[model samples]
Target: MVIRAEDVRRSYGETVALDGVSFSVEAGEVFALIGPNGAGKTTLIRALTGTTDAEGTVELFGAPPTDVARHRIGLLPQEFSPAGRLTARELVAYYAGLYDESRDVDAVLSDVGLEDSAGTWYENLSGGQKRRACVGTALVNDPELLVLDEPTTGIDPTGRRDLWRLVERLADGGTTVLLTTHYMEEAEELADRVGLLADGRLVTLGSPGELVARHGGDSRLVVEAEDEMAASRALESAGYDLLPDERHVAVPVGPEEIPAVVEMLEAADVEYGGLVWRQPSLDDVYVALTGTDVTAGGDPIEGGRP
Candidate 1:
C-alpha cells in the first residue's frame, strides 16, 4: 500500500474533526475523498501528510508519514500562498531546487498546462493559471505519491477538464494519488475508489460504479410542467408512480416506460415544459447516505432522506 490509516482520530478542543477514520490507497491507484465543508477532509489530509499530529497510525510506504523521505512525496494543500511577484517558471524552479533530483522545470510546467503562462507573474495570473502553476510545483519532484486537496477550486470547466486528463496521465505513469474534492463529478471521473466522509466518519467506500449501483436509487424521468398538480394527477391516474414537487414531477421508470408516459400525458392534455431522463450518479449516492443534497455550487442543503 502506498498509503494506510488505522483508526485515525483528531479533535480541536471539544470539537472532533476525525473520528476513527481508516482506509488504504494502493500504488498507482487514484483514491478520492469527498465530503461536505467542515467534514474534516483537511484534517485528514494534514494527518496523512504529517503536517499535523493525530491519534492513530498513518503510514506512507510502510513508514510513518513524517519518517518517509520528503523527496518521495508531493503535496498541494487546499490553501497554498506562493510569492506573488515571482513568475510561474521561477516559482516552479524554486520548488524543484528543494530536492536533490527533480524533473525539468519546463517539463513540469508543460504537464500542468502552464507553458503559455510560464513567464506570467503569480500576482497577475488568472485564478486557473495560478492554480495550474501550484500544481506544477508539486509535480517538479516527480514523487511516487501525490496528494492534492481541492486542486481545481478556482479553475474553469475547460481548465478542470484539462487537469482531469493530466491526473489520468499521472496515474497511468504509476504514481499514487490521494485527493480531496468537492465536485462529485470529479470524484466519479478520476477515482479508482472513493471514500465518503460525513461528520468525521467514513460513511461509504467503493468504486463510483459500485456505490451508484448499491445506493443511487432508480433512474427517473423528470417532467417540468405548466401545472404540477394536474400533471401529478394525470400521471397517477395512468398508474405511474409520481414524485412531485412544486414545479416538476419525477417518475421512476426504465427506458421502455418513457413512451407510455408521454402518451398518457398527451391523452390527458397535460402541458409540460420538457422531459429529462437522468441516471443515478455520485451526487445521488451522497444524498442517499448523508440526508443532505449538495447544490451546484457544492454547498450542502440539509434535507430528509428519500
Candidate 2:
C-alpha cells in the first residue's frame, strides 16, 4: 500500500472529527475520499500528513510518515495561500528545495499549464491560475504519492479538464494518489476506487460502476402527476416506494410494472407532465445510502469543502 490508515480517530473538544476510519491506497491507483462538510475528510488528511494529533496507525511507503516519507508525498492542501510577494517560479522553486530529488522546476510548471505565468506574483494571478500554481508546487518534487484536497475548486471548465488529464497522467506513470473532492463528476472521471465518508465514518467504498450497481438497483419510473399527493397515496397503496419531488413522483418498479403504473395514472386521471426511465447513477447511490439529494446540497460526507 502506498498509504494506509488503521483505526484512525480524532476529536476537537466535544465533537468527534474522525471515528475509527480505516482505508488504504494501492500504488499507482487513484483513491478519492468523498463526503460532505464536517465529514472529517480534512481531519483525516491532516492526520495522515502528521499535521494533527490523532490515534491511529498510519504508514506511507511501508514506514511511518517521517521527514523522508514526507519528501516522497506531495500534498495539495484544501486551504493554500502562497506568499503574496513571491512570483510563481520562486514559490515552486522554494518547494522543490524541500525534496531530496526534485523534478525540473520549468517542467513542473509546464505540466500544470502555468509556464506562462511563471513570472507573475502569486497574489496577482487569477483564482484558477493560483490553483494551478498550487498543484505545480505539489508536483515539483515528483513524489510517488500525491495527496490532494479539492485541488480543482474555483477552476474554469477548461482548467478543470486539464487538471483531470494531469491526474490521469500521474496515475498512469505509477504515482499513487489520494484525493478528496465534492464533485462527483471529478471523482468518477479520475478515481479507480472511491471511499464515501459520512459523519466521520466510511459509508461505502468501490469503483464508480460498482457503487452504482451495488447501491442503486434498476432504473426508476418518473411520473409528473397533476395531483402529486393523490399519486403518492396511490403508489403507497400499491406497495411501491414513492420518492416525491416538487415536479414529479418517482417510484422504483421493475419493467413489468411499467404498464400497471401507466394504467393506474390513467385510471386516477393524474395528469403527468413527463416521464423518464434511465439507469441508476452515483446520485441514486448517494440518495439510497444518505437519504439526501446528492445533486442539490452536495455530498454530506465531504463536509462541503469544495
Give the best candidate by lDDT. 1
Give lDDT tens digits, candidate 1, residues 1-306: 999999999877677788999999999999999987767788899999998889989999999998999989999988898999999999999999999999999999998888888999999999999999999988999999999998899999999999999999999999999999879999999999999988788999999999999999889999888988898899888888885331379988988889999999999999999988889999889888887654422212111001
Output the lDDT of residue 196, model 2. 84
Residue 278 of model 1, lDDT score: 87
- Per-residue alpha-carbon lDDT of model 2 for 1-306, expressed as tens digits? 788899999877667788999988899999998776666888888888877778989887778776445668899998888898898899999999987889999998899998899999999999999999999999998888999998899999899999999999999999999999878888989999998877778888899999989997677888777778888888877778975442478887767788998888788777778767667877667777887654444323234222
lDDT of 2 at 139: 94
Backbone Cα, N, C clashes tallied per candidate: 0, 10
Relative to the true structure, candidate 2 reaches a TM of 0.83
